[model samples]
Target: MITIYDWFGYELPIKERYQLIKKVGFDGVLLWWSEGFGRNYYRDAPQIVREAGLFIENIHTPVQNQNHLWLDNLDGESLTDCYLQCVADCAEFEIPTMVVHLPSEDNPYNTLGLNRIKRIAEKAEQLGINVAFENLRNLANLAYVLKQVDSLRIGFCYDCGHHYHYYPDDDLLSMYGSRLMALHLHDIGGSYSQHQLPFDGPINWAAAMKKIAEKNYSGATAIEAMNWDYKHLSAEKFLQEAFERAKRLEALRLYNP
Candidate 1:
């Protein structure tokens, strides 16, 4: 079954987070595909998800940073060692992939960053783990980084909300469709707060989900909404929205052609 995954950062407790995911009918989650202000959720996460029979498809972790320590930095060969260790941990728990951010101009156009990521992919490959690269910040423009790396193990995590955030002109869905292995499905404001619900924002769900279906993507689509915690809403209310949107996508898939 094609399942929906969610990103529940440190906002909710780990035990409650798993129960909430099961309650919402999501088979799995993206595991912090977004930023974590503090603490590594993965440090003690897998056992919880497993008890609920929920799987974690991917865990997004920091690779490159500015003014902060970076994993794929140009100055050191050891940057990737840390990243590889994270990957190793993911593999041990049967997490499928580790979503990484591309190093930016902070490290120059040097292939060192790319090489480190490549080596990370190599480590993942040895362990049968997948490596996903996501669009972040201005570089959230992810196509070029994907193209530059051009490795199968290194694929794209299509963050729908991130794309809608700063670049409405770009068709990331088509640009990286073939390489898309995961998605961060959340709505963003046209002129207000991002990560709002589907109907709460100006995003065109029909068009967006249709594009995803067109690609025949076989990956997790996590509902990355904030401020609308699953525990607060009644099941009828939650599924009412989820089922309706899913049905809309189903309709578009068959009728549009």
Candidate 2:
């Protein structure tokens, strides 16, 4: 079945957040590993999510400001170590996927960086976790790294808003297709990542959903949209509308198999 998941940021308390997500009709919640590690909030998150009766869709890893993981000449080793620990936590929580990112800017790939990815992929395979590389501004470089690694444990996480803003001309859904292990679904305005609800902005929601269905993507469609400018509506009202919108989008996966 196609799963509808929402992202869990450090917005509300863990219990409240997971409760709200469950009430909002999400099948699961995607945890942000960065916030958990940053605030040293590793222990309670999983228990709260489980008690709230929500499945952990995936855990998102950290992103760097400059010289991202797929690049070299920086302190990426520390980041890798953090991610490894995060993967171990995911294993303990029984989470199947972990979303990661490459660099956000144009940069040359480093051999050391590629080796680092390979090692991570190998570890994930051993631990039975899938590592999903998120699409950012540096699609070409990311493509190069994916080609080099070519590991089944390492797949793609297509972020709709990022693709619409950064690689506007590229048909990522078609390019990555079945290799997609996860999705960060959000809408965007012109040249900016609004992270708005699906169809609330300029993205062609129908066409994108059609592509996903055609590709037979069966992973969770996690909503990564945040409260950017929906302040006019009350939080409860906004969440209700978001759930309805997500349901409408979920309908596109009806025939997907």
Candidate 2: segments with Cα more than 4 A from true spot = 1-11, 36-39, 70-74, 190-192, 255-257
- TM-score, cand. 1: 0.79
Name the lDDT value of residue 42 in candidate 1.
58
| Candidate 1 residue lDDT tens string, 232-251 | 66534554465455445446
Worst 10 residues of 1 by lDDT: 64-73
| Residue lDDT tens for model 2, 1-257 | 22343442235565676687778677777776665335467456778888888888888776643355654445677777767886787898898998887765566677887888888888998999998888888787678777898888888898888888888899987788768899888889623456787888988887787788787777766787766657666555666667777777778655433
How high is each candidate's TM-score? 0.79, 0.89
Best by TM-score: 2
What are the clashing pairs of model 2? none
User: Lowest summed lDDT over 10 consecutive residues: which window, candidate 2?
Assistant: 1-10
